[model samples]
Target: MAHHFTAYEVEELLPELKASLGLRRFIDEEGNEVQKVPLGPEPLMRMYITMVRARILDEWLLRLQRVGKVALHAPNVGQEAAAAGSAMALREEDWLFPSYRELAAYIARGMNEEEILDRAMANIDDPLRGSEFVVYGHRKYNIVPAPVPVGSQVPLAVGAAMAAKILGHSVVTMAIFGDGATSRADFHAGLNFAGVFRAPVVFVIQNNAWAISMPSRRQTAAKTFALKGVAYGVPGVRVDGNDVIAVYTTASEAVERARAGEGPTLLEAVTYRLGPHTTADDPDRYRPREEAKAMEKFDPIRRLGKYLKARGIISEKEEREIWSEWGERIERIVKRCYEKPPLPPSVVLENVYSEPTWNLEEQMRELEESLEVMKELGIGVE
Candidate 1:
């Protein structure tokens, strides 16, 4: 007897896999709940507010950098969804290992605005002592201090995941990096270890199309970064990074699988930076303005706004109010950041190590003496 094996037939004949992977949607862009999933209005509004705040913060930081108030700043303007979506999907106990450009993730994960701004301004109270400021850490929020070295966080994240498994904790570690970092050896090494050990980790590569001045096309010949995971025996997925729903759903599935001991997943979120690599770099030198303008049509905030308006969760007036309120709040934070004093010279030598070695102590003493001499010479250090 001959049997026809159509797509539906193949699915029916196969035993159900332990992993239950799928997408979920509560509302469409047209204001209708096509899937009829229950969702709280406040969370949706909060997501929108967070994205707007991130954009405002990026703009303000650029201006501050221009005025020499900050040493450097990396803006995560267009890739807000990749950060916010993955963050919102994680449970409170989950760990996050972020790269340099995750300001949106930090804010969404419950970082205090004042503290973040203070750190960016390199104030005396900055937790990192100014040497490191971009990657804000909140132990209460399960956020690890982001490392500045590209791709370094990958191994750290794998280590964290391994620790969670050894401790029998359900917590999963999510490491966020850019596509450029994917080309680095650390990226491959970390993924290989995680896959072999079945570590409870999710590697999120936010492909913003450029790693500084180099476009991703020039970075690698791979058809998609997600495909790189296959070599390490892990499942890889590419999603519309600008689609918050897609990112949220993909990350949610990956997290659930990791918690269930299924192993790590690699998600390549295809997105754009929408700004210069950092304050010190001029993107226009390498990236075309026309390309950025075209990418603006896929703004995650605008997409979410359309979804909210379609669902009748908010009106035009409510949306405007949300934007206006967040704008004012951001402006206030920017002013406060500028008003704060710079970090004291003492902090330069502090936190050099877990405990200061004799050599470090001597250096600190020398630094203090130099500062004193400078002060005597009428040279202000702050």
Candidate 2:
């Protein structure tokens, strides 16, 4: 049976029908500051540098992947501002739950390029011990590693926020996910729980227009991803993800609200993915080449650079120097990491248990025996 909506129900249940709303933006595509936001020169410079560094690292990772040096990469070519801007808004004590494409967020939190390269290469220095590919989690930075399943981190972030609230800790948790993740059960579950308990969490959706081969249009029937929060009784915010200043301002507000013991805010960052989803993807098969080219005008790094240049914060000469020096440094790091040896196969079995189980010990012995046989036959285990 279908239920009909009355006039009051229509107005209350469907607010999108009342009036059209636009995404918040601080800068134009031409890099002109259109709206002023309360961000200083220093952090603006830092965000720009972090975006550039992420772009360079993305390029090198793709190159390394093409040559079979790196295993895989989830590039953040055009979505740098969404990650860097929001990440900069968080306090040091706050926790970050990241999606796979948050390279700028990792860099913003002080993860160095060398460690990033080491993880990409799955070398001996990789903190994950080569168990995962390009999934980053750092204890010092209070970042939780991304899981392969989409939207799974949402509940985790909500749980952590509730725990903090109960313990009377001043910590807030932010979870970053993509538009595609909204379709998952975890997303709905987390948002509902957060709304009821008023969890101190900020949910950021980087709506980059594509979820692998699926476009954003097909992802949902809602006018905007942010509005999804309204159903859960959480306030919704939409920002221009390409404009660094706008993203930072909006995220900072949301973070402060959550830290003040208010309910979570659902933030939708409208942006585009200018490259393939990952090195394994071929975006050309789904999206047009012209579309990606068209998005270059709204490039986060380009827009931020122009804004900084106009204010005399960064000169053209300094911009060139930053890119060139960072590019060279990344190349050097890649070369050194590529030369490093991979961990032995046996190492995987070492960390699974405090004391080796009998079955695991038997398997280890069998693996050793097989390695000895291969060595005797002049066959490399690798």
Candidate 3:
């Protein structure tokens, strides 16, 4: 029993759907401060360092994949500022529901390079234990494992925030997804529920202008992703995703608002994806190389470095030194991760059940026997 909307009702909703918010930007492409930055010298430098490491890590991930060291990766090449700025805005206790391309967010949340590499390399000690997906979840960091399905984590974040509200806790949850996810059912459900319940959560849409090979224009007819919040009775904010200061400023305000019981806000970070969707993708087929070249001027890492130089927080030489230093450290970490042992075949059933059934026990024994036989044959079964 589906009901059709009246023409009058559709007309009434059109005005609310109009794009109203302007993109919030603090710095220009040249790294000139166009607006007063909210962060001071020390914090700014720290963020810049994190952004650099994220870029370097992304570079290594691409290289490692090429050399067969890494199985697969969703590169965070061009969207460092969007991940770093918004992630750094959260408190230690706040929960982060991230996407596969949140390398910077993971780093900003204090996930060291070694830990990230371990997961990426699928080493024996990998937290997810060589799971099919390259998702991240860390109890110490209060971060949820990213779902492989697009936009699936949105409702989880909303539910967590609702629980916090009912418990009288000040925990605000933030979920980050890409532009393509805005069209998903989970995203809509999460936003509507958060709005109706006044849940303490923030929904960040990293509108990197593409959903894999699908351009954003094909994903939605809305003038802006932020405007999609209007129908759900949520406030929307548009920010420059390439500007770290701008993203941090807006995310901080949204976090504070959620902590104050003001409910969820839909934040749209407008930027470009300057790389392929994954290591298996080749952007050149669908995305114009000329367009990618043009986006280089808005490079987040270089833009931040220039801004820091202009502020006298770091010199040109210091910026180069920062890159060189982090690059060497990342090389060492990658070497260590490469040297790690592969997971044992028996670990597959370690956490599958509380008590193994008789059939399961028999299967485990068979597997053990097979491994022993292989070891006797010198087939590297151990």
For model 2, residues 33-72, the per-residue Cα lDDT tens digits are 7887577889899999999999999988888888988888
- Per-model TM-score, in order, reads 0.89, 0.93, 0.92
Best by lDDT: 2
Instruction: Please report how far candidate 2 places residue 208 from its true position, in Å.
Output: 0.6
How displaced is residue 138 in candidate 3, in Å?
1.0
**lDDT for model 1, on a 0 to 1 scale?**
0.81
Model 1 misplaced stretches (Cα beyond 4 Å): 1-40
Worst 10 residues of 1 by lDDT: 14-23
Q: Which runs of model 2 end up more than 4 angstroms from their true locations?
A: 1-21
Clashes of 1: 2
Backbone clashes for every candidate come to 2, 0, 0
- Quantify all predictions' global Cα lDDT against the true fold: 0.81, 0.89, 0.89
Count residue pairs with overlapping backbones in model 3. Answer: 0
- A best-first ranking of the candidates according to their lDDT comes to 2, 3, 1
Q: Residue 361 lDDT in model 2?
A: 95
